[model samples]
Target: MVTAKVETAGPLILVVGDVMIDRYIFGDTTRISPEAPVPVVRAGAEEIRAGGAANVAANVAALGVACRLLTICGDDGAAVELNGLMARQGVTLDCVTDKGQRTTEKIRLISGVQQIARIDHDCTVTDAARATLAARFEALLDGVGAVIFSDYAKGVLTALPELLAIAAQRGVATFVDPKPVDPARYRGAFLLKPNMAEFQALFGSCPPDRIVDRARSALDEMGLDHMLITRGAKGILLVSRDGEVVDRPTQALEVFDVTGAGDTIIAALVVGLVQGLSMATAIDQANIAASIAVSRRGTYVVTRGDLDERLYRREHFMTKLVPLAMLCDRIARARETGARVVFTNGCFDVLHAGHVRLLAEAKRQGDILIVGLNSDASVRRLKGAPRPVNALADRAEVISGLAAVDHVVVFEDDTPLALIQALRPDVLVKGGDYTPDSIVGADVVRQSGGRVMTVPLLPGRSTTATLGALGR
Candidate 1:
């Protein structure tokens, strides 16, 4: 996995929209209510933190960046509490308020991990109050690297169009975590991120295969340069204006609570972008951050330390065969850390000393080693009807279990040409008596500035020789 690098000056992110005080009342549910058929929650502990756009800013700060929140609040106790929490998290808040308005607050009563009740106190601001908020937002854009529109459909984001226009005029890159209400309000945004449900609301239903084209259609109508649609456990897709689409799968995670996961995604994405990472790399990092977010309960925030630790752990183990998309993500992350990747392919119908030596030596040539195994059908076509004594799954499992193998991918074709072209590893290794120039994908590796290597075969030890001896 890639190591996340922190810049000394750290990018400054400006978040605009609604801010809220999220109040959690933890209690025990021990008895039924006397007056009604309901479980009684005996209050025990209470805690409050920033929510909505404030949470986005907190996430930005948690990632070791400077964050300023421009929002609307009320001259009330909740607003005061929100401000104090933001201060403690090192997030600057520039809010516009009027005594006549009520600060938005969500009070959730939880009995252990289950929420029993919730109380919402919210209000929208008048046109004059919104104008004041726009002015405050405009004043803070001087040193901002990117602007995030964290719209929660609360009163604070009523003037989204004006704010978007203002950011465009200043040539600032803008990211929006949109509400499902309307698509037109997000016109000219550099990136619009919506979860699957929200995306379905705006663009109707989309087949899994057609998501890219669907996103492109929406981007055209809204004048957005890019759209990132988050698909829960399915990962995210980035569709750009140039008709380029990158689909990144979600990191493997054990989910506990999904609250505030979206906020974490957008925060990491904008920060990575401003740090000069490619959009695909930024989205990969964000997906990793989001995976960490869902593994905990409540509104969890991921820090830079958390990211660094997880990535460091991933570099040390090989668990099982991964999907092609997931393998691509791993390769990209490895590349980010300047690690060389070595790839080899074969139909290992039987394991032998020759295979072992080739894999071990290939691994020695790079930091990562990937083995591409031919599928059952491909093996049948190449090695005849009864060639492969083992199934694809069994062969992949055996290959992945090796200490030298970091990843194993099965290809359906007789040759690994397409897979090699897509992955473009730093070195292509093969175990054979053939010369490097005679290798199947040697030219592909050479054209991409990578080397083609041929490891010497072990004397009298081959899969065919072993199988022939067993036949007797």
Candidate 2:
């Protein structure tokens, strides 16, 4: 689970291709319409999001990187809406408006999580518009670290050959999320990313085991340096001109919607490359970002905070079991990163459903959860002799393994007052029938402008009751 730190001060990223507005009309469908056989949707809310190349720029900005989008749109209402959305996301828009064209827009009517119907309005770019876009691309390619061509085959990317040639002359790396157009159009690109279906459409299908060989051959024919084929469930396959092949499995735990996943991947990959990460490491980060995007319902912009939490949980689980001093240091670092700290304490002698529920509730209160486990000596002083069947190390290990618990530290005192005073967590939590005033660290947490919460314990589930039932 080794990962690289993404530098926010990396060079600027330029995105050029088709830009469109994705409009979602959400509502409820209770009965069929009297007018027709279709379900009648009682529209409730409307959402407008950036799609196509504009979405790539949004994802890059969300990752704390500088990005600029270059595309052509119609002088219509959709163009105005696109401007406001991109401005809010911190993306610089360099758009050319053509009076004869109608900006591309996809209107999707959604009932609950299911999409009922979609309406599309689009227009192709004129030859004059392509000339203006080409000039803009050349001017913007001077200081760009990388360029992403997000082609939706809407006539915006018909001049890809000239654009790729200009980027190559300027020594700027270019990546392409290509549509199923002529293979020669993508020639000389640094990297080409196409889903499994697009890959088969452009360059006929072959046996699963021979994808790498076929990808390498395509690279040679297209004069490409590298190719990344994204297989939805099968994950991503990377093939280089030098015969280097790397296969990575999908990281998504659940699939909700895959919209804008390709935009997320290209955005993450180019950002990683600009931040000085290896190609393989960049692909790994892209996979993680794509996984986060698919778990969401629509065009989700994966933020830097989201990426940090996912990476931390994936790679730093074993490091969670630390001493009190190290735990304090980690809390300080977490605070610096704008993460809230949560604190809870207990003997946790026997792990049970009640304990799990309590911990999960505590985690919901804050970003980072720190469990204060009573030391062996402290447990004996509090629960009497022959109690705490699990040792301190064993207890910490088990708690740290749980997803709800971020870090575990053993406390020697009878109560966690000393630990609380030292850490000064943003939230203090306890399980049982206790008021905020009665909690041990309530005063300390309150003085620091923090809240104290209590979660009700599950009945008939306690270590003492289980020990008694076992006749111990």
- Which one wins on lDDT? 2
lDDT of each: 0.84, 0.88
> Model 1 TM-score?
0.66
Q: For all the candidates, what are their Cα RMSDs to the real structure?
A: 14.5, 5.8
Task: Compose the digit string of candidate 1's lDDT tens values, residues 247-359.
Answer: 98888557887888899999989888877888888888898889889996677777776665556435534245666766787688668758999999999889888898899
lDDT of 2 by residue, 1-472 (tens): 1122333555788999999999999999999999999999999999999999999999999887889999999989999999999999999999999877889999999999999999999967899999999998998876688889999988888899999999888888889999955798898899999999899988889999889889989988988888999999989899999778879999997899999999999999888888888889989999999998999888888877667666755764433566676567667766975899999999999998999999999999999999988999999999999977998767877898799998887788999999999999999999877888899989999999999999998999998888888895
TM-score of each: 0.66, 0.80
**Which candidate tops TM-score?**
2
What's the CA error at residue 24 for candidate 1, in Å?
A: 0.9
**Candidate 1: misplaced stretches above 4 Å?**
1-10, 318-472
